[model samples]
Target: MATDAVKKYLEDTNRPYSCADVTVNLRGAFTKSAIQKALDALSEAGKIKCKLYGKQKVYAAIQHDNADGPSENEDYDTPIKTTTIELEELNTQLKTKEASLKSLLAAPTSDSARVQAGEIKTNIEKLESRLATLRDSVEVMSADEKRGILESHAKLLSEYKKRKRICSEMIEAMLEGYPKSKKNFLEELCIETDEMVDFKLVSFQV
Candidate 1:
């Protein structure tokens, strides 16, 4: 049976062997699962000693001391303990790396961010183009044009004042013996002046 074969190998070697080591050393005499089961059974039966070195189970033959000295297996315990502690620290670091990877996976991908950046850039370019067009379309008055406009405004204002004075004088003469006051007679005639509607005539300066 494979269990007998495994047990014989352990007793003959009289040294520690992990399941993987035994599988390789056995040269395909037994499948890995069969060797593992055999190792477990032998350890449970106290036919061999099993110690866990980190995540791996190592089996050794049960040592018996001779009358001359202690068995060699007695020397393995200290090194195994040190190796276990180191493996535990490595496992902790590996777990931390895995958590970081998971968090990165949950966030937005680089491709998506690039696509959004491209859209924002396109919108900004369009707005800049529109602003440039509006600036170009606006008309700027030259100094000569501004002066001409001011002169035209002054002339029209002077003509308007002259016409208003003439009309006021004619009205006053006609209202000399009128029953109502001049202001009242003007209101009855539904006449509106610039001052009545709070209108201001402002002069332009070049």
Candidate 2:
């Protein structure tokens, strides 16, 4: 007749907790005939509380406040309490709230209001287009004036090609003077600096 065995039976609602639930968990010293006797003993000891729901009489364990204290039903501010909320009631509330939220979000805004909003967006986009065009014209004019002032800035690739040509001529002259034959330039350049082809990899940008 352990209090702990009765406590386990009352806590889990999914399992069909009964006298069998107690006896099976206890394993020893608890026989089928003794199941009723255990419940009676726990009830008489005031270590259990029960509530009626539908056809089932659900029991819960009561915690003892103090050894010297009177039973939990005494005039103490804090007494042992157990709450069993009805599943049906909770389910009904959940469905009602779900329906209400669905209705609220699904309801359409006023037709006139939506049209006005679209018109306002169109006006904003038109203004932004004009602003962008004006900005582009200003940048082009500024670039032309700067180009006129600084003709010193030359194309970097033009100077690089000229230098490469001069180097090649000098290298050919030196190699021609050597008695040994020069290595093939075509095979080395083809393998080392081949042109890049189209390819893609995973990337993200702002």
Candidate 3:
């Protein structure tokens, strides 16, 4: 489906389009990676032509005329591939295993075999739940939302590192005059927010 969307978008456009441009236009429908995959597929199918410009890959739709002959790769439209339903088969297998496990659990007395069956059932349940969660996520999640979350996490980590660096610098300055062996100095080095604040205030006075 994404490949078809990409083809259509390129067909409508007069100039070449980059993966980022296609991804932005598609937005919630497909991710940047997905768009690139589609672009690769289109290139392979000869529906599009790719040219490298510096570090970027740009794609242009192949033009064809009704009266003209076909190129090496036919420039005719093809059916858009749809997502497969292999997950349905997995669900059926999981259900069968769950029923068998239930029967084993209903047996009169506990045995090693039953214990193994229970463990198997727990594993199956975990796998089934995980697959279901993934399916749901794929259906509802957007690439932009995921990127935003990642960007926020990276920003927080950057700020944390900067703060730690400032504190380390302040602590190292404070110990400049202390007489101690390098090993002992490194082992004793510790930096805290209050100490950093004090160091900044002292620096201001000097």
Candidate 4:
């Protein structure tokens, strides 16, 4: 009976849930191990889909040929809400970093300018790391979910390109102003030159 209810819940929602999630959603209607058993049985019977997301197992209700997948009445936004939030956050951080970089570039070179440049570099590195993480997260999403996120974020993608162009220009400016040693340092960091930085890899358009 609990297994049927669990299957119904998955079918109605059309989303994946971890075992812990299933236990919480069921709210003591079934023991955690019991729910796990049901999920295993469902997977074996082709009644549900089960896969590992990282180290954790997740289950989603299987959609049959005749069954409706996502209904017209269903909330489409619910599926990619986390991705939306992440993109918004990334846009905000990118904007902040862009402003900082612009400001750093506008100021005349001084000890303070060098320190600001270092800080900007660190922030950019962190942003790149976040971008790589976002890409990985997107890869895990279903094709439709990934398409939805990319379509909704077209403007964000444009902003990224604009910012990349700005950064490239700023790097050229820095190379012109800084000594040879600074150029060597940048090369060692694999940045090499302003022209060498491949903006396409980080572009959301890609």
Q: How high is the CA lDDT of each candidate model?
A: 0.86, 0.57, 0.71, 0.77
lDDT of residue 112 for candidate 4: 82
Candidate 3 — which residues are off by over 4 angstroms? Answer: 66-206
Sort by lDDT, best first.
Answer: 1, 4, 3, 2
* Residue range 94-204, candidate 1, lDDT tens digits: 999999999999988999989999999999999999999889975678778888999999899889889989998988887988998878988888988777899887877
1 against 4, candidate with superior TM-score? 1
Clashes of each: 0, 0, 0, 0
lDDT of 3 by residue, 1-206 (tens): 88888898887764576799788877759989889999998998888888765566777787664455555333222211111135457778999999999997887665777988899999999999998898888446587877777777777767877887887787678678868854466567542354445743211110
What's the TM-score of each model vs. the native?
A: 0.46, 0.27, 0.32, 0.34
- By the lDDT metric, which is better: model 2 or model 3? 3
How many clashing residue pairs are found in candidate 3? 0
Q: Is candidate 1 or candidate 4 better by lDDT?
A: 1
Residue 27, model 2: Cα distance from true site in angstroms: 42
Q: lDDT score of model 4?
A: 0.77
lDDT, candidate 4, 1-206, per-residue tens: 76898899898878878789889998889999999999999999988877664466778886565346555233434444564568689999999999999998998789887999999999999999998998778357687887788776886777877987897788778778676776585776676544566534443552
RMSD of 1: 14.3
Model 2: per-residue Cα lDDT over 92-125, one tens digit each: 8999999999997787669867998899999999
The candidate 4 region of ten consecutive residues with least summed lDDT is 72-81
Q: Is candidate 3 or candidate 4 better by lDDT?
A: 4
